[model samples]
Target chain A: MDALTPHLPVLLVLTPLFGGLLAALMPRRGPAPWIWSALVTGFEVLLGLSMVKLVRQSPQETITYFIGWWPAEYGIAYEIDALNAYVILVVALLAFVSTIYAKSSVEDEIPKDRHNFFYSIWLLAISGMVGICATADTFNIYVLLEISSLTVYTLIAMGKYRDRRALTASLKYLILGSIGATFILLGIGYLLMLTGTLNMADMHEQLMLMKAEGDLAGNRTILVGFTFITVGLGLKMAMWPLHLWLPNAYTFAPSAVSALVASTATKVGVYMAFRFIFTLFGSVYDSSATLALMAFCGTLGIIVSSIRAAQATNVKKILAYSSVGQLGYIVVGFSMANESGVAASVIHILNHAVTKGAMFMACGAVVLRMGNADLKSFYGLGRRMPATMAAFTIGGLGLIGMPLTSGFISKFYLISGALHDGKWWLAMVVLAGSLISIIYVWRVLEVIYFKKPEKRAPVEEAPFTMLIAMWILASASVILGVDAELTGRLAEFAARVLIGGAT
Target chain B: MEGLGLFNYWIAVAIMMVGFYGVIAKRNLVKQAISLGLFQTGVFLFYITMSVYRAPDGTPGRAPVWEAILDGFTKDPGPYDNPLPHVLMLTAIVVGVSTLSVALAIIMNIKRLYGTVEADEISEIEEAIEHREEMMSR
Candidate 1:
């Protein structure tokens, strides 16, 4: 209702762009860029929250923000409905919280000279993520996806200062990421060939008409386009099989990159995949054959990655593999194609973000203290770094989908949805994944609490700032689990919107 | 296939697969990067191929420009091709150039660190580093 509503879309994007440039230009000062990033995230989070409120309150439950006052059908616009509003807010919240946590971790991990540039790249990554989530234009998403991905490669490569392997890891990421982006672009081109439009809503209407007219060739083109987009985005999101580049990327990248990218980057890819499959290509991809394919891949990703995690020795690799498996849950939700299934996917997005963000940040705290995050290195840390360990443990419990955490809430909905859809085996597969994940979580717990420290182990808790940030997310995971009503309701609404097809 | 003149698309797919195979199948760092470039060119070719539109008599159109849309031009230029794909490719080409440069720069950095750009050699060095660390931890 306020004057800000119209400008909210472009402002959401531009604020971070200008903030990043400002942060990059700050005088040689430590933490100045950090403070700047914190402020930018704070402002963006408020904007995102208010945008979500405005969209939900609107009769149409969608906010169409046209850039430069162009008509909605012709110009670039940010389409925020129940689905992306939830994702954008979650991403902004994590970006803001992790920026606070990045201060101490970056100081210890990165060279002091790179801190300002690091903060700038971090802000750029956030802005790019916001752009990808907000844009209604399909071509624009590919451009923004490249924007965020390019910045992330640099952010991860910054880890080379501490561990040289980060160079190769980031190189692998760069090569793989380029391929993914190209595939996505190719997919967009295919759609343009069919509908001659890039605006998602317009394209949907065009596709509907094509289907109604019994356009077999058009449908065939769409199916090919859908495959290209899915494969490209699946690579980007680290889908189970094409996930060769993930473990090393996570383990060797700076801890802050691990947390931020783990929470937001892949989630954006997941969101795009969800939008393309359920919204843009709705009904077409929601059929039994496609859902069956997704269910198979999703379950396989879950079982395989969980097994890999249980066998891994490095803590970051374990968490990284765990993330791939967690993403599979979201994929499975979409595979169900029902209201509850889509809602569960939405709910799991937020839950996994909260829990994984906390866990990785805690790992960063450990790395900051001891300079390594090997499982063997966790011995006796529960006593020395009590607060950091507790945060990690609480988050680990959440990862295990234990009660009193957001993980429990997500799993409950996901399983119920699977059962309701008569895919009882999928529910069992999910439970089996949970059972496998417990072993890996327990591996960390046993090392941290049960084993005795070597004579030379360091004795110190993480800096208070890092612990504070970790607790913020770790506690939120608990609170969200205890009362899943809000996430549940919002996710249900988002799901209903998705399953009801684009309005 | 005979009526559609699909050979252009077939060639584009062939080039794309070759480039994709090089990227995934080759082990040399520079080879992989070059293959990435090749693969993008394949995509570029696809877009270019898709952009080609023939008149009713099978004549390619001119580039869309000021003369094509003025409504009072001396020579009546018939329907222009869809310039959208052309514009989209302009952006894609720019992105591909940037990606290639960044990838090459990373390869340079890797060579400086381990004195080798071969993927296997680099992994060998990495394994040596990991092996040493394992002993130290033990």
Candidate 2:
């Protein structure tokens, strides 16, 4: 294990990539594709764990691997610190579970001939997101962002076999995502022009030097670049007002695809924004106004999206809108830019990933059994699929930030962060969002556990494979809620790293 | 003179905005994809503009190709253009092409399914379908 430490970062990306290629090459029909991708992602979970251990055990608290042995300024580098290692682990674990869940769900939704390609794109999407988390170069992030975004588009489009709206949704996302990516490219061009470096840390140093030289005050070009980046990442991460693409994309996507992408992709986008705002531009840039704007938008997003979730009759749409609301929490947390606030954001990233991933998987199970995910389909689901609904109920409680769930722990930090920052109104908004979220989650729960089906049809539980995957994530959220020490420490350490870098 | 010196940037911005307007204003899906391509091309042009290098003597830089055939490599390859942005843009162009192809493929599928590539028409069709689905559930 020690001998393999040096290659961990690149391996995290390459393993899934090559695995995806190999999965693509598998014969059009068989269990080979599913088994192969599952094995790859299972291995990825181990790689992710090892990476976390490496970053934790390291003296400097970072593992920086320069690709091709080139210096940082000249070539791309993979830098794993406390923050991204946590995210990478979340993404890998979710990908593995989603793969296991996808086996049954994909067979049900997608035609047989497309199974191999489905797994291929699934693994490729994971590779792209893992690459995004690991890379230290700004341009490399763009490339990986495109890679992941393209794969996700394809994954979402494959849902057309069941519903034609998937094509339109995928196209909508493609057009918007491409524009967002181009804006990022333009922003990076400006940064490269200013700093003459693509390495994030190098760019930070250069920006700091420029700030010291009094060259950055009222700098319009840099400001424009920052605006472009913020707006672009806003669109990508589904920040409020720019989140038009998210609901349809998530709603129309295949159940397993929704589970995987919802839990990981947007979180990675938030991670990218965190990298840029806090790490790259933190000390040198006066972004308080921007963050204030973000906080405002987040508060509004939380309320608006939660209400929308309450209004949606479709189970998938409800979860999708709730995702936007949960993301608003992270945005609000990070926008505070305080240690507690950033820590809360970091913790919520994990909390929401686990909680939402589980809930979406449960919904996938429901879709598998019922053939639709409407609220009515959930009637008496508790009795029909006791285990699935139980997992989902736990996830729901997490979404409502009830105690003994991961959501409560993050919300605890968020409210405290808000109070610490003397933003009492923000704390109130947090509570308000959680309260509104209850209405939707409660709406679903009431139907699932209480309401009787008009014409009762015997419904069996989701497949064992799907149940195992769902329960793993569900139990993870519960465990995180109970323990809270390990991830809490990691998130606190990550927050310190981010806040420490700013000064 | 200043405007002339920054002529490349003005063009990039103009082309980018033109594409952006089309992306927002145009109803056709194919047109939107084409406009997206235009928008990306503008950014690519911007990146390319950043790569142009000039010496202190105001001499235009040569291409960054190694001159090994001339004299085993010039000891002083004075004022060579920045090779990095060009390389970056090369990758960006490939990504752009891939995105375009995917977009077109999805559009093709959309046409086959909905029988139109007009965004509003498709959405209308979608709304009707959604209404039907909602009613069926009721």
Candidate 3:
């Protein structure tokens, strides 16, 4: 059992993959696929929790599993450290909740005939994301990224019911996303050509040896590879100029799809960027210029997205723009390259996932009942579905960084880190963006609670499964906000692991 | 500089430039798709060019696989065509095809709804419609 514990990371990814294939083949019975997905995801969450516990107990240890029992020198390997373990837990929890929420939400949003297919794709996407987080090999990351992205395109395209624009948005995403993946693949090829290895640990060891011997050829090639990889991953994470596809895709996708992807997809991309920047190149490169460029772009994204959010009329689009701004904050946090800065960003990965997931899921409930996600459609929603509206209100407060909510913890750490770095201007921009967030969030609140109902349209509360899931994440947002020590330690440990420390 | 020829890489770069130009300048969506294809093909060509190996006697080196099999696998495999770039490009081509197919499908849908496939025309029409709606509301 002690030996088996090290293999739990690989099982966390494989279980969902195999389950997705099996569930896809199952006959389209009544909610069977959804049930199967939930069961599989539940098991995954258990596995993730066990891994987290294992990490806490032995923070200094690294778990390496070789595929097919082949030697690590030649075969593929899965490496799990404290950093990826945290990511795995986040991905699994969001996937599980989204699956449970999708049970009724998908029924109302998607056609009946397509429900099983949607669940299957959702499982596949989760599996792919988990695989990307778990793998220690660069080539394996690219393959897993493709798997996740292809499934995402299909899932976003499934939003044809809401608007035909989803089809176009999905297509644009496919084009840009493929370009990004291809660039990453090319970059990986460049690395393999120079190093003659695909395993990240071996590559690191070899790179250090080469550096000691003053091997400029390999070093230069690796630098070029790093540049390509950074640009490629940047496009996927929606870092400014390349973020053209994000707003439309989020706005037009189905409510549940939007919620799931918003919570997890870009977060995973940011994680990949962090992994590359801090892990593979951390020791070799003085990336202050790179970090500065990222900071500049992130600040621009925050400003642009904040203004866009305020100007937008569609509730989902406003939230979508806000997501971009929130992601900008995460980017800037990491760019500071300080321990507290990276930790705050890492913690926000979880905080933002739950907060945004709750908010989007609440919006899904509103869309299900109202047939639209426009701000006007939410007039007096507080009186009708008090539970869901309350969750939305809480999520809004969290977005604006109110006290006793998850957003406050994230913003406080980010601001403190910026101040520590003496980036007072960046800190001011962060606060300014927060101020703009207040306007849009208040707009939603005013329509939902303060304004009068449009007419006597029959409305009902969100179903049990959805409300349960929303409350789960919403409560977590508040609980984590009040108790910051647990997430803070995990984030610090993750940063250390990424920077080549044992813990 | 003594023996290596840079012409192959230059040709690949030219092809890539043409493709990029097409993607930026083409009016039809399908033309843009073709342009993307061309650009990817150029990249593949560039990778192949970079991996070329020459024998000591001045002949082109064969792929390493045959030499490994024929020499009882004892000798270091002769410098061969780099299989790594080829493998990577193969995956890249598939990704390009997937993206192209999805792009074309979207173009078809856009045509079905908007009655045109020109990007500028579609934008113009949308702008005109938005303007009329704004004026009427005022």
Candidate 4:
């Protein structure tokens, strides 16, 4: 245990990757892929917990591991700072629960022949997301992003059995995602040409030196590089106007895929944006304009997505639009560019992941029993599937930013930060968005609890595995809401780390 | 202005913009894929062009050739093409090919489902089908 302590982060990423490959090779048999996925995810969860423990013990230290024993300055490195450590825990926790949930939920949605392949690619997607969060190298992030995205397309395509629209949605996402990735690569090339280094620390130092010496070439190239990168990452994170692919993709995807992606993938993109803006380019670039862009677009995203959510008839589409709105709140927090703001964004990352994951999983249960995600299908779900409906209610309340839920803590800090910046109008807008969220969430609840059952057909409760996963995440939403010390401290530590301090 | 000249990058950029225009404006899926390929090739050209070194003696020069098997195995590094960018572009080309293959597969699926490869027509059909479904439900 002592000897294994230092390599936990790499193990968290590799466990899923190796398991995915092994699962793909396993003969199509009873439960082999599911068992493999669960075992690997269980291991990852343990690794995540151990790392969180280690992080608590050494709050100021960053755990840097270079692949193949290569030195950090030259080789690819995984930098586990306080922020990413928290994110790793969230991802690992979700991967574990989602895999357990997928066993039963996927059996219903996906065909029998496709189950093994589905689990294999599911683990691969998880591995890719974990790798994205853990890596420190810029180019390495793009590679991992492609790995995750390609598998995501495959996973969404798996939904062809349910809805053929999944194919078109996945295709659209592939095109836009490839364009975004190309832009990122172009920006990275520009940075390399100007600095002669791909190492983030080295590039930051060189950029500062060149700036101090008044090197126009360096400054101009860096600014161009930043523009290209911000736009690319913005598209990936689904910052408004660039989020064209999100609604249909989420709406048409299989419930398990929607749940996993809604919870983790975009959050990882948000993590990348935060890392770039606050860590790599924080000191060199005047991020005021960039922050203003984020604030303006984020505010618009909240308004647009909120309106769309209210108008959406399909349950998954409503949740999808709500996710876009929730992402706006996260961006708003980040754009505030203050301590509480960054902290709020980080906490929202975790909170939103849990809340959205639970909600989607609950939606999956409904879709499994009812065969449709239209809001009408949920009539009398509260009495029919009491546990699942209760989980959905909890998740819904969290989404609406109710007190004693994780969402409240994030909103509290975000609003305070807005007011701190004397952006009182922005604060009002944030509250208005939450108010709209409450209306939509209540709509769902009203249909679930108050409306009479349309049919008397017996609806079994969601499978035990699905229930456990949904309950776990839903419970975490409440537990973390009350116990903010862990997420709060980690967020504070991460913000300080990005600013080059221990706090 | 430099070794390997400035014309190469201009041509590459032009090709890239043409491909970009094709992708954005063309209605056929196959044409979009072809345009993407063209755009990627342009990016490859830019990398290769940017890698050329300045010629020694302030004159344009070409890649070094081996003489006498091992005549000290040394050549003036003047205008020798940077091997790094070439290697990188080779990798990028393979990635481009893989992406094209996937895009083609999606196009095939679309064709099988909708019986058309023209984007505007497919969308029109899809919208009509959706409208019909809504009417039937009503």
Which candidate number has the best TM-score? 2
lDDT of 4: 0.84
Candidate 2 docking classification: high
**Better DockQ candidate (2, 4):** 2
Question: TM-scores across all candidates?
Answer: 0.96, 0.99, 0.93, 0.94
Interface RMSD of each: 1.3, 0.8, 3.0, 1.8
lDDT score, residue B33, model 2? Answer: 93
lDDT by residue (B91-114, candidate 2, tens digit) is 999999999999999999999999
Against the hidden true structure, what lDDT does model 1 obtain?
0.87
Off by over 4 Å in 4: A216-218, A501-503, B1-5, B55-84, B132-138
Model 1: residue A254 alpha-carbon error in angstroms: 0.6
Worst 10 residues of 1 chain A by lDDT: A283-292
Better of 1 and 3 by TM-score: 1
Candidate 3: pairs in clash: none
Instruction: Report every candidate's CA lDDT.
Output: 0.87, 0.93, 0.84, 0.84
- What are the candidates' individual DockQ scores? 0.66, 0.87, 0.35, 0.42
Among the candidates, what TM-score does chain A have in each? Answer: 0.97, 0.99, 0.97, 0.97
lDDT per residue as tens, model 1, A208-289: 8877777844467778888889889888988878788888898899998899999999999889987888788885443466
- Model 4 docking tier (incorrect/acceptable/medium/high): acceptable
Of the candidates shown, which would achieve the greatest lDDT relative to the real structure? 2
After the best TM-score superposition of candidate 2, give how far the Cα of residue B41 lies from its true spot, in angstroms. Answer: 0.3
Off-target runs (Cα >4 Å) in candidate 3 are A1-6, A217-220, A500-503, B1-4, B55-60, B70-77, B105-116, B121-138
lDDT of 4 by residue, A397-471 (tens): 999999999999999989998989899988998999999998889889999999998889989899999999999
What lDDT is reached at residue A132 by model 3? 92
Off by over 4 Å in 1: A217-219, A284-287, A456-458, B1-4, B69-76, B134-138
